[model samples]
Target: MNHAMATPTGNAAAKITRLPFLPLASSAVAKPRNSSRANFYKEVLESARDKFTRAISFQSKDKDISLAKALHYVAAEDEAYLAYNREIDAFALQNERSDTSSPHDAQGFEAVENMPMDGKNMNEWLVEIDAIAKEVEAELVSRDIGCHLAEVLEAVNKVLFETRGFKRSHVVVDSKCLYLHSVLSSGSASAILLSVIYIEVCRRLNLTIVGSRVGDEFLIWPPTGNPEELFKVTSGRSLFGIVNGKCVDDPRSKASDINSSSLLGLEIATNRDIIGIALANLIRFYWKRASKTNYGLMLTSPLRSAHRSEEKFSKDNCSEMPLLRPQELRLAIMASERLLILQPHSWALRRDYGMMLYYNREYEAAVQELSICMAFAPEEESEVLEPFVEKLHLMRLEKSWKSSLGQKGRLTVT
Candidate 1:
């Protein structure tokens, strides 16, 4: 078995450890200005700044400074995000634990218990989701439902779309749609998130449903197993497969089979992928916001329909545009960094991070990271990006030469 291609199919899959659901934790985030919390925040900020400055000036030579400090910041931010999720756990536990009033409130805890806390709390909103699944299951079971696959799928769809009112949103630039809490709260989510809801519900009902790409978007496919068998062997839920890098070496495979293994043999998006997607959504939010303000970074094709285009994302009626402001770019970079925290092995993530570094104008750092990306990227992707990466390398080389010349007091400006 190729080490990279080896998969934990069947029993071997059970041994893979995951981010555990720890006891509900607390956040040590700094408080508001003029308070004790403010002091802590200021101290941390100062420490990070000091580290950053020393790293830049090569004063301490203790830490590589730029990469090290950025990673440290990412680590701390990752912890804070987990803490935020813990808060959600506590909230869900508190709200849905004691309440036997509604089936959702009653079973919500079970759903929360089922999902491991992995720095995100869409699971916190999942208790009600569990309740809905049980309710749907109970109703279907009561109707003496047969093992007809299409009928079962229709039932699942009706319960979710009509009864629960779960629907897809048109907003590509809204980060709120990515959060399960926000989705349940708003009764709307993006295609991916809504598909998540569908998959979760079906899985709870012992359906072997999976989310697969349909066109440029994703949808939950119906189960392939026997309904009775699904009901019988229900105890633990399977972990979603991780997309550590390119989804597939060959894009051709993706067009033919949506369930094809991703790099690292990830058959589906893991919790890390979902979190990465959410963070990417945040980056898009800022990008979209900046687009409206007529300033942004990279641009994409126009929306397929007006219904989905929350921001016009247009200026000269062309589908593409550039609109990154410094602050917005920073926020996007931080989100991408957090995604890297969640998925360290992701080559695609490293590529995005390197591009973000370029957007931030740290040419040398960008080239360094992108150089690593060259080793991991698909052959075709590498070919397409080769010229751009070379240009960045050249820019960094010239920059280093100028600095060295200035240090020698031999720099001449023409």
Candidate 2:
């Protein structure tokens, strides 16, 4: 299949290879500078000036400056900015095509806007939401829930469909389908399943459920409650509740293991983080498949081929803009930057950033970013990316060699 459409722009001479590598520095990353908001400005620009100088040196054709020396520096800071923009552009394009639903409509089902409400009464909101759920259950007719946990999903899906036209595929995408598949296929922990699904639906429905991170688990709290009332649902816990006609949890169920103030508040989860989480789960799940038959190749080959083919199909039939909604895409792009700043040493973030660059047609920049990523996180080099990079560099070398030979030939012929 034609990978041209999916591949970010550039000639064959700029790609970086995917290979086992060593850490450029280390794997440790500093935590967010602030708890509520990410102060990524300082950290993102946090680069060594020598790296920029080294990059400038590469522009020189002097024989004394070796290729390796030309490349060794703090890393290209300007390249990082260019790559960040490339990612934003790619994300915007994909989301435009995946416009299956609009997330902006704030009206609840049945024009619940004018519905009579007992003002300021928490009990009334809970009752109303349950009543809505019950009414939805009784009135709506739905096909069988085809998968596991299908019943709960069917009940909710019906509510969303009747209330807010939420399509199944959108629901699945918003849910951690990628992560769940990795977990189930790989047999890892099952903790994040329920929260992931709930959060996905909530986002689509504009229900304002905030995501939470607790210990090794994930959680969500409905926006209808005070932030203090948030619970531990993300941990795949046994209890759930409803507030203001929304499913939620009472604050009493908050995990004792967590600090009260540090709980993830009303802020929405960024698409980048969600995607990152999905990818991490995929890597972790496939970590143990070191054998030949059910090995890393087995896991990655199909995935890579499928991605390539899907990219080709999308290109042939349609264009890939961004895979996320516009506002969501903005948040993702910002979050990715924040992540890179906070976790400068994270291989996964670097690799993702590089991949983002590659898809955006910033080939040379992608190579540089990915090289660093490979250095930090060598274990998960993509076979496809590696060959692409090698081919790119070789092509450039060949072109230069051919140009010199042609010049010599012209002189000799003269």
Candidate 3:
């Protein structure tokens, strides 16, 4: 929307513009095999296709549409779902080697493992989390729970529920813990550690928790739930009771009092979202660190490093990152795009997207995207962009100034 700051041209246009979207057709379809896991994804894709087909039912019966348009419509509804399902399938195949032994001996056997359901009873799960917290408190004397932030989070995740047959919802941490990691440790490491913990905890507990890819915060999906209702769930709780980015606790309020803006917040999101935020935060963190030095070299180092690494991987016959690489930041960008689709007004997602573009070497486009992000930032964080933007402006200024000096020197020599 901040059209004043058009990108330096090229890919920036594609990155910032609201890409025109289209719908799919009904007649073209691809049937998937019926394995349980395959079938689950297949059903989702089919349902998406069906819903899209239904929406376009009014189209002229005699008219024909391209298969590409139909695919696009289905993709628009659920890009992340399709992307992740494909990743899951590819990973399964890559691990599926010759099984000369029993079915249990298969490397990909765990792909079909039943979803964790330890939290069928909320009371029981809560008791288990409490017990694990106590154990962690007790273990501080025996083992250093403060080795690495990720390790601490991982350890807590593993011991918290495995001992008591329960799992805590996304890794719970106070503002203090996040501040320590973000300020004291490496930004990427800190973001990833917290995100992994948050995600793994939810998985263990079978809770519908997500990583809030926006801020350095995490929350369970639904903060509250009814025990008596047939489909009652505590996960996926709306934060709509929050107004102007803060929660309200009025005694007169009912559950339904929460509004759309507050309740539908995307707090617990996917790993993709986490990675996006991490990348965004990393850019800001690096920019800040570079600003204090008053040198342009700092700005180029990390990006060049990333570019080199990306090049190395490509040369090694890997076009994309391997799943075993826990810190696949690219996945986070895709996740951020998904979040942006779901919650377009989210300044956080916009920030992440801009940062992603910046790292992807779409510098001018990155600046344009980030300019929009700066405009939407709350008053408190508005100043956060001033230094970074100034640095970019200064870099350009210095380059031109030096160029002029070089030209004048050449003229003098002549």
Clashes of 1: 7
Per-residue CA lDDT of model 1 for 1-414, tens digit only, reads 222123233443333223221111111232332333233333443343333233334233422222222323323343334443344445555556785332122113222222223333433444667777887777678779785655556567667777777666655655556555556666777766666666667667767555444344553444333323322212231112111111222364342233322312324554334444556776676555644566433421221221133543222221232444655555566566555555555667777777766655567667655555555567665554455555456666677877898889964699
- The TM-scores of all predictions, comma-separated, are 0.48, 0.29, 0.28
lDDT of 1 at 212: 44
Index of the highest-lDDT prediction: 1
Highest TM-score against the true fold, candidate: 1
Tens digits of per-residue lDDT, candidate 2, 339-377, equal: 454345676677665554443333455556655554445
Better of 1 and 2 by TM-score: 1
Q: Deviation in angstroms for 409 in model 3?
A: 28
Worst 10 residues of 2 by lDDT: 67-76
What is the C-alpha local distance difference test score of each model? 0.48, 0.37, 0.37
Q: Which ten residues in a row have the lowest lDDT in candidate 3?
A: 20-29
Better of 2 and 3 by lDDT: 3
Where in model 3 is the C-alpha error above 4 Å?
Answer: 1-166, 169-327, 378-414
Candidate 3 lDDT by residue in tens digits, 60-131: 241232222222233332432443356455546645755432222212322111111121222233343345
